[model samples]
Target: MQRSIVRLAIGAAVFTLFALHSAGQLRWRLLDRIETFTYDARMRLPAQAQSQAPIVIVDLDEKSLAAEGQWPWPRDLLADLVDRLFDDYNIRVLGLDMTFPEPDGQSPSRLLSRLSDSAVGRLPGFAAASAAVSAQIDHDRRFAEALSDRAVVMGFVFKQSVKSDEAPEQGVLGPPLFAVEDAVDYVAPHGFTGNLQGLQAPSGLGGFFENPLVDDDGVYRRVPLVQAYQGRVYPSLALSVTRAALGGAPVSLLFDPPAKRRSLNLEAVELGPLEIPVDEQVAAWVPYRGGYRSFPYVSATDVLRRSVEPGVLRDAIVLLGTTAPGLLDLRVTPVARAFPGVEIHANLIAGMLEGQIRKKPSYYLGLEVVELALIALLIGLLFPRLSPLAGAGLAAGVALAVVGGALLAWQLGAILPMGVPVVFTLFLFLAQQLFGYFVESRGKREISRLFGQYVPPQLVEEMAARPQVVSMEGDIRDMTVLFSDVRDFTSISERLDARSLSDMMNQFLTPQTRCIQQYRGTIDKYMGDAIMAFWGAPLPDESHALNAVRAALDMVAAVQALNPQFEARGWPAIRIGIGIGSGDMRVGNMGSEFRVAYTVMGDPVNLASRLEGLTKVYGVPIIISEITREALPSDWAMRELDCVRVKGKERPVTIFEPLGPKEELSSSVRESLARHRGALQAYRGARWNQAEAAWLELARREPERRLYGLYLDRVRQLRVTPPPVDWDGVFVFKTK
Candidate 1:
């Protein structure tokens, strides 16, 4: 009962911590980042419905720039382009994704005024001719005339701060949507860069293009639909364009009832029958249809020349912008890294028209709080009574449900807080499990103390969890056993003092032991300079032979690594050999009642010991029996050394030397291995001449390898002695 109480208490504490974070009483930057990351990922998913609203982008692209000269082209050209768009293409609404903060410097009137002030003004007819030309080519007036009474919304910018050297105000701002006092929540700009009075007066509609709610990570996932300037609320370019497109509908603010001691709570912005849900900051999530070029792009040059496909832009809402990098209108958006700023407005306008904008209302916070509370009840109150597996299942189910719910809400044009609830569920589950583990660890500790020395610490923990898997009585099972012994150990030990020899042996045995444990092999015993280990017992590993062979190879490498240190200490460089064999073996605690120890004993174990001794004869670091070779995967590289019957066994067994995994073998080594296989086949067939030739070639190419020389010697001797015709090719060992 006390244990359950402790578990529940831990769960409750963790729940409370995240619940506070969910309710905004506490802040966790990590959770906020996670939320933003998930939001981006969700946005990238295939949208349930693509925006089919008639929206088009009037892109001032590289082609347009090349054909029409550089950006900020003469106002007359813009005026002409505007006329073509309205007269030829019949665009419904046009919104500029650029700001015009100053009058055009290249206007014909300005040029003529400059000319008249020069010495040329003294010439006859100069003033009169200049006046007539100026009136005919006054580009700013012509551009303003093109915009008059049309559904054209000019773009502007909102500055967060005004520097002393910069103008505090520029051009002209359109009428405000509502006074700041009328709304409870808004993002107020310090200053703005509006369109020219001529342009603003002609259209009488302008919207700020600056995004005030770009995420802190510099990703434009959400943008405020409305902002405040000089105590008046203003709409963004997309909102303004949308309003104009809807027959210049009167936009109104929708507010929730004021809370105690709180002002009116802004919820949505309404224009005609369309309602756009917004968060507390009056921001709406960008409903990106896809990546770049989601909307049809009609190059400004093509539009100006009337070369666009007929009906492509007829009655279509167009956003005038540029994809040219030199124009500096690129933005980092959710769907694309270098997205055209104009497409953002197009997507927003389309979203507004189709009613596909996702809403994340202020009440989402309260909803998340409720979610956390339910999770707390499910985990804190119920997890303590369930088993660890059941608790884990519950936690996973809760996470899936939370994510599923969030996705469902998204599909329904809403966004529910997902990251915090999911994180809280995981934390509470882990806390409960950890508490349960500590409380139940006393029995595990006892199991460790009993068998810790014989098996790995991990195995002991497994045994503690499933005590029935391990037994004291001997049982016969198919397994793999490994034996490793240092070469010339007697001679090396004779040179070192007792203390020095002990330290050297300890240094040598530690890494070899670690190799065995890392490969999930159990140490059976350690004789003077030899180590015995086995796999496939206590915890049955199906890859017993493969793991044993891998451990043997690693043990040989470990000994080689220590040789340099030994030589530095004036000790002879050490060499070791390993042998592995697989077959049926008896494994369990064995000995007199007073001194019984966990170990394995059988024919395979004995054969492994003998193979270790034969490593000296073959001059190889590691060897394995035919059974062990058969168990390994084909990826392992092995060379058949010999077929021999030891003194006590009548049946001959094939022995092989491991050349490491095939992938690590050099090309030359692989070639040599192929030749060696042919040579072994010849020797086994009693083809003395062929065998001798193959062995001689191998010995010549690899003079340092003793195995080739040994085989070559055997072939020459057999040729000379001329064995009987009935003689089998098995070599017999008469001694251990």
Candidate 2:
């Protein structure tokens, strides 16, 4: 419970940190960058519907420059192009994306007037003839006449900074949209470059083409629709064009209630029937349709030659701008790098007219805080109770839901914060997972330290998985016990020095212990040169007897394999005898209070020890009691040794020697086993002559065979001193 509280506190702290950042109490640059990235990604997605607003770009491209000469084309040509757009094609409104800051220097009247003041003025007919030509070819006057009484919006630039000695203003600015006393915040410009006086005076419509709100990353994602200058508000070129296209509708600034206006809380820009959303800085989000060339482009040369499609420009709002490299009008936008600046204004004008400008309102910060809080509460309360896998799934689901919600809000013309909530969910999940890992690690370490020495490492690991099921108290369980001891270890230990003896013992016992553990048997303790172990303890195994038997066989092989190395080291070759038995036994931690050990004890354990002693008598490496044999699988190949009563045990228990798996027994071994069984049967039935003959034959076949010789001698004794008829065929050992 305390751990859960710590986990919750950690999660809450994380949420609080992010919430503070969202609520403007703190700043995180990473979150801002990620938010901008997500915004760009959304802008690049395929639009559901193409913008239906009829907007066209009159590109003064390289082709137009080739046909109509270089930039700064004479004002007479511009006048002709304007006439073509307004008269022939019947365009709705024309917005000049380029500014004319000075009068046309190539005007014929200015040139002729200058010439008239020169020595040519002294000629008789020079002044009269120059006057006639000047009246007919005055380019500036003709260009101004074309703009008169036409719905044309001229473009201008706003300077963000100006030097003390540099000029602060140029040309003539259009009428302001609002006074400086208006109750709204706006971007303020230091200076501006407006169109020429004669040009702007005739049209009486102009807008600033500069974007003061370009992001810090140098990407143009949003543009200020209106800026404050010289105590008056002015609209952007796109806003001016949109207003002119809508029959000169008046623009009004919308805002929240006066009480909610804490920090530049302007909401939208109201233009007649269209309500264009604007951020706090009075900037509108550019709803880019795609990359460059999203809108129709008509070359200036084509407009001049009247070679465009008949209906392409009819009633369309046209923007005259140059895409030539020398003109330098390219901008980096969210959808495309090096996008034509004219298309950016075109996209804005189209979006404003369609009422599709996305919004980032002042309440978005509050919404983000709420979203983060709700995500934190849901994850924090549920994560502690869930498993690791379930917790990961919950985190993923929450992240997906957050992103999906943000996308849905984007579709509805609202851009909620997308990166913070998703990142917050991920960080919170990691915190909880790390905390849970550390907490669980403590329990695992305790289990390992306590049981690591007694059981195999794998069994200790298994016990750690479900620690609730592990018990240390003594209890009775049906299990298998194994006892192994080196043959003649007392003599071998005396032959070596103490250090060498210890090394030999370590070398001999390490592999033997590993063999026992390899088959899932747990080592109870190492008794000098002997090892005592059991199976089905600490962790349960139904096949305990089979595992013990297999381990005994492997242990004998392990000793035999170590003999050659021992001989090379001038030590005696080693042999080990292992005995196994299976029955109900008291198993678990048992000892005095000062030194408790997890061990097992019962009659079956004693039986296994006694069997280990008997292996030297039978000259065999492994022996198993009858109960253990019965517990093993039927496919095991074992040879019956005897039914004997060791010292201190009244009832006789049958024992056998394990050969190998049934499928692995050689034919000769099978024949020897069959003959030995026949001999045992005959002897048990008291057929003295037949038993004697069979034992003699087995003894003669292998002179070094101790079991056959011992049986033969027993047959002879039984023949000489025959007991009562009720006597059972059980061998009784007086000494162990």
Candidate 3:
């Protein structure tokens, strides 16, 4: 029973580390995305559009084209319309939805044989002297030139992986118009902007990714900010237009990684006056003024040819797009079933100028952390001590209070994280109850195994007031494992008497091993001076690898940082050897059924020990199996520590040594790392003296290291009593 309690105490200490580290990482990612998800389309589109004034649209209708005759209108006719807007009505910009990729069909063939062809009248390089452009071509072409000269935002696409049979001259309008919310590679995955029937040449373009946002009920939600395409991020059509209207400021999507809050960037810079609440991906619900065609749709022929009165264009930004049945630009919208696309632009402009923006802030992560702590603390403290009914009542009250708190925070301009507190609270609470049922004693042991490495002993005791989460019967789970051993302990043991060895072990190994348990690593067993542990078992730990790998590093750190103090007291300094690996492992009681001992058993466990043994051969402290290295977060740098098979293994396992926290390692340290690897490689190649020189240098920096001293003694002995002639520089261990 006493032995069980000791194990429990150790497990609890380690278990707490497992809880805190995983809690920190998860709270960062999940909560961050949750915060950004609040940004909506209804608000942003309006804020930007209204800010850009003097905009208008021209729509295609059956009546306008019928009266104007078959579709392909002549350049002279377009030129005439341009003259009217510029000369007759004094409108400043005349954007065209039409392209001049083809020659004006209605130009008078023989009229331009001499000097009559103007730049606007002919295609860029027509062989024949272009004839006088027809009324249609003359009107539209002239209008395009005038608009082009008025600082109008020109639109065109880079044609990413476009179709081979597509018209070479045909183009979509604009570049990726906005930044991604949490984008690392800058891919636009949520927009789609299609081309019109070559109408008013685009002033600016957006909406290429244009994916519809669907709510929980499978209904449409908000508009997305950008579209990720071909691994590149692009801007939405609304964003492009807003950028153009706002005098061509670069537009980017600002994403906060921790909070997942999203806002718009104008002029390729930080988000200005427009702060729209969006998801971490910047996809949001687009509340419409009503469905499609809610805006007043006028015939293009009416506006361009002066058929409509002057007052009708009064201070209104017009958008030109199609509504004719054959064209199919018509679609269902909030206001109407057959909305004109042009009016969508106008509405956005109106909304922007009116300052209709909604904001989602970056505090979302903190809220989740605080809430989770609250729930975990509450459930742990209350459930065990209170009556079942009372516990149930308290839980219900807490739920109501939490929901109310969210609403209250929202009202006060604070968007608190909503789901995490509830989730963590429920998980911790339920796990404890279930733990109590199966093996309360074992559960306590399990807890010590997890948090013992990362937190203080006192803090762990405070947390013990809550529920226990350990179980004697382990469940299947993915985990990160760490294994470590003292180099040459067998020889070192031969030299000391049993009592001296025991005292030395207590002096050195006790504190060193305690650090591992402090990091919430599950202590598997101790083989003399060796310690074996794993992370992310007995509970779900998404950051299992990160926790275990980092804990191994921390163990080395704790030992090194204290070694000098040990030297001053005439005690031998401690040096550790560690190996880390991550993967699925079976963990449970593994001894004889009569005397079962809880432990993890799998390839990962073996590999972890192997990795640790390799550290001595490679002259480094922290070695990780390849799988564990790959599973770690990308922030840490690990040096490859050569590939080798242990005595009983066939396949070679690639081993790596973690230096320290990546941020603190310097050039001098890196140089030492480089020299150390080179010397270790030489030692493996039977260059014993070269290996000896490397140790000498390392000792210059770190004198009296336990592992290094062991190696130096072995080398001296080998020089005098060498191995057989066939000896390759391989060291083999007889037991685990």
Candidate 4:
């Protein structure tokens, strides 16, 4: 028991270590990928039902390229496209999905400037040539004019760690959205690539399209709502477009209730009336509805040519990007392998509008730790006491509860850790069950060692398989009980010396015990030459009654076979009477605590012993109660002897002598069984004349059978003094 407790302690310690590691109290790299994958699955769960958001995408797809030639279409064409979006289609806000880091070199104004700077520039007419050329074609200036005084946000990319010798900073940037006085400490990028000055000067704002928080597995599950670069925080494209749509309302960090003993952990970012929940990293989990094409996509050529349906982009927040394979904008995500990167931003914008962005704040980690401990503790204690099948059920129930809780939190726009707690619960349950098995096996071995010599080997092996079977608790089951005693053993014992008598009993008991054990019987105890045994215990036998009867027949045959050997040694040949009864009995380790044995006790067992005594009076080797005969198959041949109330019982039970198989009996034996049944029926019916005639004939044919003679004499006496009319036809036995 002390060793078992020690093993349980070790299991608990191992579970605690894993729980602490999962809670981030210990450093382990093996768990990082698992946690990340768990987060990915959580993000892909179905979001709360929401209306179709006012967000749309203007895709530069293959159709657009076929209609409008290759990309880098002249700057005037891009200017014209921008003009069409705001001036013609009347979009509320337009966000570009691509970047413009360098100026348009193919513009006519650039060509004219390059030609004028060459040797032709020294000519006097070159000034006239330059003025005429620059006046006609300045596409960059024209594109800049198109962006002014409009709700337009351009895209840029950031670098976390820069190694390039070239300048990492370019283009113009506006003031940070969160003021310096606000004192927000967010993650900052090392370098950035912004638009050319000409375009930057006219745009309303710029947003970084590149994600700085992609997970180690390269899946974009969370997008930063806001990021910091060079001590100033900037908004992402999704946030920039949303702010523009809301009429340029300023975005602020929310930390109404700060974390314990630390600076405030960012909880959410608020834009006017719209609040977007965010984690400590100022990122929101992407609420993916499905794969790509979640938002409505309009071809760029259709939009430019005004071929799109009217009012499609009227009040929609439009993102201009390409889906063509050549554009290289595809991304790997949880729901889809080849998800368009532009659709990611569109999803975020829509989520912000509907308040569907789920977040995992700093407090969730503490909740995760608490949940892990509770789940592990529950299954660890539960699994040791239950069967293997029940243990597996408990583990499955814990997993479902954990997963359901996580999903419920997601529905409420909160994130909680799921995988660690679930995995920990199952692992702890399995460990505890395995440890319990090891402990239980040792207990079974102890039982086998103690009971090996007392009971049949079959019973000992059964006890080894299930240690619970050997406990002191008693159980009620239908079982067969057997009792056997050598007839007149006292006379034989007086004739021999003590040593000779001991040798004779040993030789007599060994073969009989062997026959009993070989037929799956459990030896209960031995009283001198009398042996008590039973079946249907420790391991249940549905055919217990049949097996007990067969073992009794085998025991009688075995004793007969040993008679010659006994005579050769000058010892009297043994004759035994066996009694068997079947009924519900209590079987287990039963007795006072001072002295207990695994044995059976009940009325059926007492009756079996009583019937053993009757076998000597009736001159039959075997006597079985009616219940035992009923439990056997129909082919077993048995002759009903009498219905008699025993010494201690009010109810009268019919007893029978078991013969060999019905088909194996001789024709004369079969005719005798029929006539005996008829005579018993007539005797019970009080037809004294017919009963006397049947019994006389049976006695005359089989004069050696004493049972028929005993009944025949009773008929003659009962006829002289007739029984009362109300007699129930039950004979009473005064001796056991």
TM-score, cand. 1: 0.60
The candidate maximizing TM-score is 4
The best candidate by lDDT is 2
lDDT of 3 by residue, 1-736 (tens): 3323533343344335334634574234543343334322222233222233555565667887787765666655555554555555555333333334344556544344333455544565453334324333343344455554342333323333445655533434445543334434332322223343232343343343233453333333345555566555665545555555455665555444435443322211233455544554554334344445445556767766677666545544444456677766554444444555555545554444444433334445455555655565566555665544675676667766776776565444344554444444444544655555455535445555654554345434433433344345766668887877767777777777788778777666667666655665566667778777777644446777877876776777777777797668545566778888878888766678588766788887777877776676657788777787787767776776555667667666677766546677888778767776777687666678998888788778867444456556767877888877886655555544
Kindly list the per-residue Cα lDDT of model 1 for residues 551-580, writing each as its tens digit: 887888898899899888887888898888
Ranking according to TM-score, highest score first: 4, 2, 1, 3
Ranking by lDDT: 2, 1, 4, 3
RMSD of each: 19.3, 9.0, 28.0, 10.8
Query: What is each predicted model's overall lDDT from 0 to 1?
Result: 0.86, 0.88, 0.56, 0.82
The TM-score values for the models, in the order shown, are: 0.60, 0.65, 0.37, 0.66
lDDT tens digits, residue span 61-103, model 2: 9999999999899999999999999999999999999899888
The candidate with the higher TM-score, 1 or 3, is: 1
Give model 4 RMSD, 1 decimal: 10.8
lDDT of 3: 0.56
